[model samples]
Target: MLKNKFFLIVAILLVFFVVYYTFFGGNTASVDGLEATINPATYGRQVVEKRTEKDQFLRTNAESPILDKASFRGLSYFAPDVSYRVVARLEPFADKTQKLVVSMSDGSEEVYEKFAHAVFSLHGEACRLLVVKLENTYSILFRDSTSGKETYGGGRYIELDPKQLTDNHAIIDFNTAYNPYCAYNPRYACPLPPTENKLPVAIKSGEKYIAHE
Candidate 1:
């Protein structure tokens, strides 16, 4: 009798596990091979190198900078903070076709499609951020309290891989946050970050403010 009861309990537990995995766990991408071996420090290093290369390119060929007259001391950035690198849950917007009217620096308006709402934690504070897409590319444009002070008043931007959007996991690394071209030169019309995307904390990572002449 005892043996029979033990077998019955095991079978019941197995069924419960299967149900949970099918509904919830199944939404996440299966971690296998190289992805399982990723190290945070290695990923951080790669991001820093990429940002440096971009700055080099912009300094040489970017028309937004008054390169002919302004003194370029190279771009500035806060040291990469690992705390700002977070894996967020991607919650698809109720209506993918929802549109947002984005304002541009040159007194113009543009439309952006709502992609999804990213639920994530930053500095121990839980928050939800809107994800926007233009054409087939997805990205996040946000403004933090650091803006107009430690960073660009127009806000900062980061690109998101479309593959990761519905994988249930989205990687948001503030270390890659960048200023729009308008931050350097008003000549280029750049989209202003929407008020709904503003954060209350100081995100002291990524690019720093460089006063343009």
Candidate 2:
């Protein structure tokens, strides 16, 4: 009888440890908490759920690409006349030069003109810089940055779409930046932002990195 009781006690303890480790004892929980605090609208519960859904979609879907080809056939707008520069290199994870492109936009009719080059840190990893001009807007894609640490590791992406690109004006807002689908799941191969796209300053805007359960 005593032996049976002892075995039962051991089993109970094992179950408790498993529960703790699976839920509250890992980095997953911490990431969940961060997502909750950042997403005030859903009150945090939906953050994990949304991430899960995105992961599932990326894993099962096969048509998504790292960078979607831009359609600028009908776009006609002069470049913006904005003067902005990267004040710092928050983190670098690529081999190419970092740059900042500012658009001259006044709320309506944005335009992307020139890009200012800057230095970046590779964060002990190697990456490449890809510059693609689509339609009337320009895209800078690269990998390796504070994105995984402060943002998403799969890398964050910023674009100056036609709507935001106007004559001598562009709407460059970090808050509007977002993570690619690959950030949620490893199955997806989203394009990493180029080193040139890395901003020297901390863009405290846009979506924050999320942790999956």
Candidate 3:
């Protein structure tokens, strides 16, 4: 009787294992479904470097900067804290365009304008341009610098709150910038970064291409 009970228990455990694997294990259909949703090919092409625990913690928990009153093209503003690394450079723009004009606050002064054409990336996606001046606000623009070559050519962007602009400088990390959903799949219509926003540098930080074997 003791031997029979042991055998029964063993058989039951085996059955449970089989059921779990069949439902949620490495089934081909399940894997295919995941790929269909996010396009593993595009994901695999990306390369994401690991971040230090301190940097990760800061990125997730840092408090956003609060500005008294920032406006771009007459729009209200709110600033989002960005942090990224510089990458490489692309081709220069025509007409000997060298730098991009950036406005920052220097604490003592109310507003300070400077040029920073040397935009870097955390990943392959290069930054593109799309500056729009709406009623009371200005639309901050950017795009994937490596669209066709390394990343999605359609590109990605971040919206800046003009109200947060201060004399003090803000961190613009390319690693934090990401591609839109359309880059992974063709079911969405994402706005492409305009030509003016294109940075002539290669940003090699942030989330990399997702890959699956």
Listed in order, each prediction's TM-score against the native is 0.77, 0.37, 0.34
Scored by lDDT, the top model is 1
Model 1 lDDT on a 0 to 1 scale: 0.77
Worst 10 residues of 2 by lDDT: 72-81
The sequence of per-residue lDDT tens digits that candidate 3 reaches over residues 22-89 is 65453233221221122233322331212334223323443311121122111111122122422223
Residue 192 in candidate 1, Cα distance off native in Å: 1.0
What are the candidates' C-alpha RMSDs? 9.3, 17.1, 18.0
The regions of model 3 sitting more than 4 angstroms off are 1-141, 161-164, 167-169, 210-213
lDDT of 3: 0.38
| Worst-scoring 10-residue span by lDDT in model 1 | 29-38
Model 2 agreement with the true structure over 50-128: per-residue lDDT tens digits: 4455445534455533232232111111122111111112222254334334321122222232343323222333322
